[model samples]
Each structure stands twice: as structure tokens, then as C-alpha cells.
Target: MTKTRIMIALVVLLAGLKSNGQEALFGGQEIVSPEINKDKSVTFRLLAPAADSVFITGDFLPTTKMKTPMGEMDAPGKKLLSKNGEGLWTYTTEPLASELYNYSFIVDGMTVRDPNNPFVIRDVSSLTNIFIIGGGKADNYKVNDVPHGTVAKRWYDSPGLGMDRRITIYTPPGYEDSKEEYPVLYLLHGAGGDEEAWMDLGRTSQIIDNLIAEGKAQPMIIAMPNGNVTQDAAPGMGSDGFYKPVFMAPKTMDGTYEANFMDIIKFVENNYRVKANKENRAIAGLSMGGFHSFHISRYYPNTFDYVGLFSAAIMPREDATGEVYNNINETLEQQYKNGLELYYIAIGKTDFLYKANQDLKKQLDEIGMPYEYVETDGGHIWRNWRIYLTDFAPKLFK
Candidate 1:
């Protein structure tokens, strides 16, 4: 190419890089959205000169009634934002308790995330910005200076489901350096959640790392498998192309998942350096995953020495069928006969599955099945689940 032509092309490229449209899109000065004050109060801001109205919705806010497909129910509350002279909308809240919270902005009636905050999480299909208030229970949810563990996304063959699926595994610190074999904790997620649920939303790695460092919990390996039988992995992560996630998927609560549960256990035991014995193994889940924990623990009697159900769904599905679902009482009897080191059940008083868990306790009482029951405040929510894990993990593999 001629020198003149090359010089002209360079000039044109430089001009395009500094174009007005490009500047408007990426050249603006950055502003902080969520600013945590010394007193723990948070101030949220947004610059929208043309926006007619703005509001902030968050789980930490007060509860309000919202309509859903099922009916009008209590949902997270939103607060209006006031605009300053520079057209910057802002809102400040009273001191918040130490915990992780998710929030979204409603600008001109459209819900959006805080562009300034890079921290976010995806629950099902919805994504929201997240921040942590340190110095209490939330301290465990944050990444501190303690030794961190390794988290890997691995694919394992599931012959029962006729496909290769993904699983999230968390190996404790020093796992790779030491010659020790760790105990395994099979953590399951609820419906609509895939292998990534516990790792992302539950803060499993951070909590466990903090717990182990504090000497509150034993060092162990956590294996999270997708509970949805029809899915190979999280949305857009498997053979099925990119797709939106839903609250519930086909064959979630069915017996098929339980029937093929051994595949995950086998994969973990075969691949990882774990103690492959009942006394060294633990199983726990939340919501529908809790339901699976209940059935799987009983069906595979003498498998797990420690079992936990957090706000578990305990009702028997009449339509579901398989060897796992059959002879529930007989399986429970066998499980009790085999012996359990610790059977833990925790639930919030207002959880939808409270009555079912209570009934389960009653049946266990009839048979004199020993279990540790913890009843806390609130309903079926992540706050309770995180608390449950914090309380439950310290008691395992002891």
C-alpha cells in the first residue's frame, strides 16, 4: 500500500475511536452507585438527567405486597429516590445489619442493575447487584485474607440420564498440597437451580473457607450436582444452546433424579481423593433439594452419616414413583437401624414447608428416630439457608 493511503487510513481510525457516539457510550466519568458509610448506612446514587422517576428495590428493604401468577403476596420493598440539582438521584438508608444483600434500580419504571457495581449474581434467570455488610454473620460470606479453596466446574458422565452433565466442586485449601483425603459433602440445590446455584448464590466457598480457617468446621470437599434431571447443566452451559432459566423444570421433583443420584456420588468418589465411607460423608439441601435429601438418605440407607434438611419440602408426591419413593416407612426404618451420627433438620416458622417438616418430626418421634431440630425465624429464603449451612457444617465429620 502507498504511504499516503496508509497515513489516511490511520487518521480515519483515530477519528472513529474518538467519535462523539463512542465518547458518549464509554468516555463519561465514572460514579459510585453504592457507597457504604462508616455507620453502616448505605447511599445509592444514579445520574439520569432525562429520567422522569427512579426507585430502588432490595431484599434488605421492608416487605410489601406484590401480585404474582399465584396471588398477591409479600415481596421485597422499594424506595423512591430524590433528584439533586445535577439530576443525580440518591437515597440513603439507616444502618443495615451485617449480611449480603441484592438490589436493583427502577428508572422510569424499568428495573436495572447498578452499572457502577461490578458484583452481581444470577438466581434462576434474574440478575441483581450484590454487596456485603461486614462484621457479623455476613463476615463469613466475604473473602478475607484467609487461605482460599479451589473451585472448579467439571463435567461428569451421567449414564442414567443418558448425557454428560456438569458439577461444581470445591476442594478445601491445602487439598492439592497435602496427601490427605477429605470427607465429602454432597450439597444440592432447589428446583430451577443448576450446578452453579450453591457456588454463586449460596456463597458456599467463602463460608466454608471462613469456617475452616476459624476452626469451626472440618475441611471437606463439596460436590454440587444439578437437581434437574432433564438438564445437563445451567442454562446456556450444556448441549442445549443458550436459554432463559425458569423457576421449575420438568422431572425436578420426580423420582428420576433420586434414582440416578448414585452417578454423582460415584463420580466424586472415583475422581477426588475423598473418604468413601458413610461415616465420612454428609448430605444436605434446601427446599426441593431438601426433599431429595430426605428421600435419598432414607432410600440409600447407611450411606450418609450426617444429613441436613434446610427449609425442606417434605410432602410425598403421589404422582412420583420409583424404588426410591416406594416403602418410605420401611426405608426410614432401615436408615434408623443402620445408625446415623447426626440427623439435622432446620426450618423457619413461616416457611411453606414448616407443617410438612413438623409432620416428619412427628413420624420420626413415633419411631424414636433421633435428630437435631432447629427452628428459626423467617420463611423460605436464602438468609435462613445460609444460616443453616453455617450452623450445620460445624457439626459434620466430627
Candidate 2:
């Protein structure tokens, strides 16, 4: 098991596997599934000969009558994939709008990915193959010839949580050459999400780069941190391979996440060259992360001027306090009176948490809280979250 012996053994094993054709295993098959065509339409193919049936699932399809948000849309309720003589099942989608989409193959009722496509992203919420439809608003997600930003997987010590945790940071294109301080955006992930959630599925870096390049958004640093309270770090960095002290899961009944959040702020301010003030700070989150934003901005009204919530999981008026945000409508009024810049809330009309958002809106309106509300077509999926980021990032520090 010495280092050299292990390497040689691995090389020998890999060579033996490739010796049959010598190149097939290394280069992959000649077929490419989930091919994005120049016309914006996409072709998906799977070589699942043993599968009795196959179906394709992704954001490209409408979200109607789709049992679960992750379920592939098949009108008349299901899309029966077509089988070919080569034991390949195929499905081609109509021209799709430009955006990042998640998809997967359903083979005989089991979920699988396109063997031919290597680009895949996963989180607690969903796992699927991702493809980009180039055009329109999606241009922000596409990789253009713009000056790109740098993304770092950074770790900071949290005394409050008594552990080391990770956060993904994105510095805009000119950050390295310039010593000027930049604004900070504390982007949080939802339940079952780690620091990598936004970095992976949300396409945070690409969107920020495109926005800054187009002069739509300021050159700012985005810090995406793990929002789980009970878990000191994300899955791979944790002692249990996931959040533990099982009761500490942020989503669990115990309420402790918001209490320890200052460690994150302090970590950023101390380590990064950021303008640590309300005018130069923004905070946003999706789902559970949204709930965090609503409270964090409310509790510490002077902290972030810009707040965004995408498909937020807000509590009803009654349960909004005690375990959650400090139960005080007066605090909310104070938040508005304290020079809050942008209190933006966005949700899909079809989202399961739509009613919660409605209640939050009602509370905000009753309190005369000046905030912006955006409603898109889909549910609590990454597409809407990405759209929220695309729009919200540009509106910051203006």
C-alpha cells in the first residue's frame, strides 16, 4: 500500500480494463447524449438496452401535473420514451429558452443519468444532468468572452459553532489587481444544501461574471456559506459525513442557526478585504436560506441593505416568532425604518411554499415594509433560484 505501489497497481488495473480495445474505455463511446443543438433544441439519447422503459426529466418541460418537482414532465402525465433498434431510447425537446437546466433519465422506473454526458451536479434537493440553452436571459449563465471571476473554496474558524466550516467565495474579475475594497454579498444555501449548493447548481460565478462584465452589476465578492446550524461544516468536511448531533440540523425543530450567524460575518470582514457596512453588504437565500435572510436582516437591521428571498420558507404570522425570528412586528417596522435598501422576495406561483410567501407578503404590507416581490412560472427549483440571482445581483449596491 505504499504510494508508488498503489499508483502502479491502479495503473495496471486501468490498463487491463482498457486492453480489450485499448482506447474504448479511455475515450468513451462515440455517442453523445443530451446534445444542445445550434437551434436551441436538444436531443437526449440513452443506450439502455436492458431497460424496459425510459423517460427524460428536466426543467425544459412545463411543471404541470408533474407529481414531484424533480419528476420529468410528460404530458398526458407521462412521456414514454421511444426505443430504437440499437437498444437506444431517444427523446428530442422543442427549442428551449436559454438557461441552465437539470435533467435525468428514468429507466424502468429507476432514475439514472445520461451515460454520454459528463456534466452533472447534485445536492440534497435534486441530482440531475445539466445543460445550457444559449440565448436571451440565459446569456448570463452562458460562458461568453467576458473577464471571468475567481471562485475559492475557503475555510474559516467559527468560534460560536466551535468548528471549522467552508464557504465558497467569488471575487470579481479585477479583484486581484485592484486593492479597492468591494461590496460583499452573503449568499446562503437552502436546507439539504451545503456551501457548494449555489456554487454548483446555482451557477453563481458565471452569473456574477456576466453581470459585472455587462455593467449590470458592481464588482462585488459573493460569499456562499453553509447555512446548516447543527452542522459545523458541510458533508465532506463534517465528522459524520453530514450534519450531526442529529438534532442540530438547521431544518430540525431546534432553532439555533440565526443565533450563530455573526461568526460568518466576522469571518468575512476579518479575512476578506470587504467594505463591512450596510451600504456595501447584501444578503440573500433560497427556501430555508430565504427564511434565514428574512430573520438575519430583520434581527440585525443594520447588517445588510439588500436582502433577497427565493421561494422562501417563511412561517405563518403566529409561528414566525419564538423559535424563528424574534416575534416582533415592531422589529420588522424598525427594519424598514432603518434604511433597508432592497427587501426582495421572489417565488414561483406554483411553488409549494407559495402560500407562505403570500403570508410573508401580507405581513410586510401590513407593516408598510417597502419591498419588491417577483413571481415566476415554476416552483422551488434551481431555475427560478438562478433567475432570482441574475436579477438580484444586478440590483445590489446601486
Candidate 3:
């Protein structure tokens, strides 16, 4: 063939390629990675040219049954993926409830973030992509136009813990200027969490701000302290780093937390302009934190008038021995006599700790302790905790 004819044919082919919208490699048309449908269903897509299998995991999907510190349990949701001829993998979820969910992609057995989704959150260990299904309960998870609070990472001297520890503080709107002393909530984190837990995964600021704006909650200071008794901070940055394994910290924490408990209270009381009164002080935690809140409030019965326990790690059959129960019941009786305002206990009906909470309630009933019990829908996940906080905070200092 002549050179001129070949060149003309190549030009025609190039023009056809450009006009046909045929991409060079694998991408051509606009691909929306995660498209939230009007019906609240979510469609996720990923482009992988060389992948054998792809799977997606999130709270929106049920995970395999696995053993936890509480006991052996199975998760709630699960999802699989399908591939198309264009090397694009896709999966669509059924209509999920209105809530905040974190998800990740597993491409050929290698876990990865959603390359197409830019919104991601860093939990204790790894980064997970996140999406919000906006509606009823989920609305609290978002940042609204209402006045927001400030979350500060501050370090304080914990002579009780024998080291300087870090804590996250959230001062509500108008706190800096308001000469009025505000009520304080001593919020604590669960196991494997840090001072950043409530502020990060729990959506502390967003919830508090939105509630305060809507008049659902009074403006109060929330002090979230790390609850790892053995460790100083989170997994890292502590005297006991991640290298040091802490299993069932609730069972193993002899008296370090109790011994150092007053130190944290002192730190918060002295640093913040909180009203130093029993009615103005509240203590609450989830899971291991719930365990801590249960004990700490009892240890100093008259200290905190308001107590909240979300999925508390209460072991009545084991931890609540005869002697312990006798002492705790005595304190419980004293707190009741001293006019305890609110003794709130909350846990998901399906939580692994559900049986434990029930046992604790039985003991409470036997001791004639009057407390409020809230049973939610889901298990021991953050959804319940966040909702518990949203519900519990409004009832504070009222």
C-alpha cells in the first residue's frame, strides 16, 4: 500500500476514535462511584482492570460471625460484588436506614479505601470511607448551619495515671464568653478508643451543636477522656503503646482507673468553668466505658447525679461478686437517698452485652435501686451510642 493511503487511513481511524467517545484505556464516560438514590439505596462502583474478585464491607452490610470480648456473635449486614465487561465492578445496596455508615473495599483480598470516594474517616487503626443517609436520626450526624462547637486536643497532667495524658474537650457555642458556669458531661470512650473516639466516630460536636441549636439540649461542656486504664493515650503515644495488648481491660483493670478517676475529674473541674455541683455533673460511657461509668459513679456516689451507660460492660455473674455487690448496693442505696436525679442505662436489644445488662438490672431491682433503662434496636455498634448520646444529653441539667 502507498504511504499516503496508509496515513489517510490512520487519520480517519483517529478521528473516529475521538468522535466515538472511545477512551484510551478503561475510562471514558463519567462514572459516579457512589450514587445515593432517591429511595435511599446506594450504588457503589470501582474501576479495576486487573482484579479477580472485589467485595465491599461496612456497617450497612452484615459481617461474618466473629468472637468478641463480650462473646461469639454475628454481624448484621453483608454484600457481594459483580463485574461487567468494561472491568468496572458494581454493587447496589437495599434501602438502608437513615444513619452514618463507614465502608471499605476489598479488591482481590486486599482491603482498600474507595478510590472514587474522597470522604473518609480515620478511626483508631485504619481509614474507612464513609457515607451519610440523610433523614430522621441521621440528620444529627451531619454538620448543620447552626452554631458549632470547638473540639480541642489538649494535654493535662495526670499525676494519678502517673503521666501527662491527652483529652478531648468540646465547649458548646457561646461558652467562651458566657460568664455563666455550664454543666459538664464527663463522656468516656470504649475499649480500643482514645480521647478522640467520641469526637471522631461518635460525632460528639455535631450532635451537641445541633441539639443545643434546636433547644433539644442545654449548652454544656463535654469532656471525653481516654478510658484505657493500662495505657495513657490511644494505642500509640501512650506509656503502653499498641505493642502492649490490652484484652478485656474491664476485667484486668485492678484499681488503676478508680485510683486515677478523681484525677480526671479534678483536671476537668479545675480547667473548665463548670458548675461544681452534683446536679450539674454527668458521667456516661459506652461498652467498657459503660463499665467505668457504672463503677466510677458508685465509687463516688454523690459526685455525679446523672449517670448514663450505653452497652456497659457489666459482668454481674463474674464482676459483681457478693462483696462487690454488697458494697455497690450500699453505695447505690446512698446515692438514691442523696437524691440521684437520673440513673440512665442504655443498650441495644441485640448487643452481646444485652444479657449482662439484664443481669445488672436484676441486681439493681433486688437492691431496690431505681434507674431508667433504654433498650434500642441494633447491637453494640456506634449507631446506638450516638443515638443514646443524643437522647441522654437533652435530659441533662434540666
C-alpha positional error of residue 352 in candidate 1 after TM-score superposition, expressed in Å: 2.0
- lDDT per residue, candidate 3, 1-398, as tens digits? 99999999998887776665425532344567678999999999877768999888888886567786658654644466899998888999999889999888888888898776878876546678888999878899899999988788777888866788888899999887778788899998877677878987899999999999999999999988877655566666666655643444553334457546888878888988989889899999988788778888887778998999999988744544423335777887777777788989998877888999999899889878889999988787888899999999999999
Q: List model 1 lDDT by residue over 223-341, tens digit each.
A: 99999988898999988889999888887887888888999999999999999999999999998899899999998998999999998888877657767788888889899999999
* Candidate 3 lDDT for residue 120: 82
Model 1, TM vs. native? 0.92
**Count of backbone collisions in candidate 2:** 0
Runs of candidate 1 with Cα error greater than 4 angstroms are 1-29, 65-74
The residue-level lDDT of candidate 1 at 224 comes to 94
Superposed model 2: Cα runs more than 4 Å off: 1-28, 64-78, 242-254, 316-324
User: What is the Cα-based TM-score of model 3?
Assistant: 0.86
Question: Model 2: which ten-residue window has the lowest total lDDT?
Answer: 69-78
The worst-scoring run of ten residues by lDDT in candidate 1 lies at 20-29
TM-score of every candidate: 0.92, 0.86, 0.86
| Clash count, candidate 1 | 0
